[model samples]
Target: MPVLSTVGGSGRSTVAGLLACALSAMGSTVVLDTGPRLSSPWPAWSSEPGTGLLSLPPDRPLTRGQVHAAASRFPAPDGGSWQVLTDHQEWSHPPLPLPSDPAAWYQLSAIGGWQAVIADTVHPVAHDVLTARWADSTGLTARWCHLPFSVPVLCAASTGSGVLALQTAVKAASAEGLPLHRMVVALAAVGEGRSPASVKAAATMLEPRVRAVVQVPYDPRIRAHGIRDTSRLKSRSLEAGRQLARAVVSSAEAAWGDPLPAAAVPRTRAAAQARVHDTARIASKKVPA
Candidate 1:
């Protein structure tokens, strides 16, 4: 599934990285960086830094067979195979342009044999070219939103702006006959912001619209460094990342019916949201005065 944000700076990239790493630890995984940027976080903390999708020539038409042939395996903690397909160029001065056609990239990835393919998209509405294309091709896209109460959280806009962008994304998906099925809401407590009650209330508003809602808790370390900098993550942050990963895995299985290895049973929606509320408390408790 392609992971996208309604607005920029929604921690979508961070969530994408965590999800990719977690799935990689479980089984075969591939992460494709489709964001239009000079740099990507995946290479910073990735076990194998140099190997990426950039190895494939941008001048030529990309194919699934070509992508599979170019894919490089990265080491996961569980001794599983993790492949990272980054679009960042090795040359720092002149950055290479990421592929413009999201459809082709999605097709290439769909053909490749990867348990899960997470594409870190820029945005679903204004600046994004990937999610619209992905949604059109697959009729589905997973949105990652933080601070859904119309408040500014990270680099993203207010919750209202994010929701508006989400509506646009949903419309695009609907045009393709695939209404959005799942969404991941990050209740990040970066500062003294929304209360747990308010967060839950916001989630409540969204629960009825989507099939599954994955809630990611705020981890201060993630806010500080980045998701790729796993070394800087504390116990709470690490646990949060693990929890987010598990949610992604479970959601993917439910959405695609892809057989996942035996793991914890997926939690009920109410139970999962309750955990998110509990996470808000833990995050607040751990915050420095």
Candidate 2:
């Protein structure tokens, strides 16, 4: 699934982290980081040494183990965690060839092991449908929209302008033949006194049109510290994450018109070895009295 918004500060990363954390309860979850050029907060929040998305193999058919190994861990609930793969380059270093296409991002999540993958995407994919960028629609934005068995989690700030942008975005996406019927919309609270009439009205109109419209409550912690500490997030915020996850699955089910197919491919032996090493490292953290 891809978490996207046409505008910035729509809480894409926060939603992504929450969804990843909430989805981890179902099984293993991993995050395909959104930022590479300017970068996301994945590095700052992570304690482990970052392997980075660039560290992943450049081949078309990537090895699941190697790809998984490159991910940086983010703590989740119940002692479990999710993985994030992003650029950890320094400011002075010359930029490397990063994977800008949706194919590369999609490939990382599809390799295997993870039961759920949340792709944190900042690109205005829906907005692209109405722009000159639509000519090359076979790339990132369109790919996210048209990919099979995929669900798009459209996010918007709970404000007048934000809702307006989302309304336009959804309309453009529908015009481009994207699955608006199976899409999930998220309204992120911007700490306003209350949702403006426009935002509320849009949600009401879009509710029956889309799968579901969820309102993510404003959490002061998210704004002050970013999405690093999931444990400290408010209960309402976490509940919203769970709601988004369920909504995503429900939309997927609606698209399938039946039970969704399960992932059956086994992870590589190398992946198992990696897990063993990870377990050993975690165990090494404990000290005897």
Each prediction's Cα lDDT score? Answer: 0.53, 0.78
lDDT of 2 by residue, 196-266 (tens): 89999999999988899999989999888877878888999889999999998888877786567864343
User: Which residue ranges in model 2 land beyond 4 Å of their true spot?
Assistant: 60-62, 132-139, 257-259, 262-289
TM-score of each: 0.62, 0.84
Model 1 regions more than 4 Å off: 45-47, 58-81, 88-93, 110-112, 126-178, 192-198, 229-232, 252-289
Global Cα lDDT for candidate 2: 0.78
Worst 10 residues of 1 by lDDT: 146-155
Quote the lDDT for 234 in model 1.
58
* Model 1, span 46-81: residue lDDT tens: 554543565666445555667765655555444555
* Model 1 lDDT on a 0 to 1 scale: 0.53
- Model 1 clash count equals 3
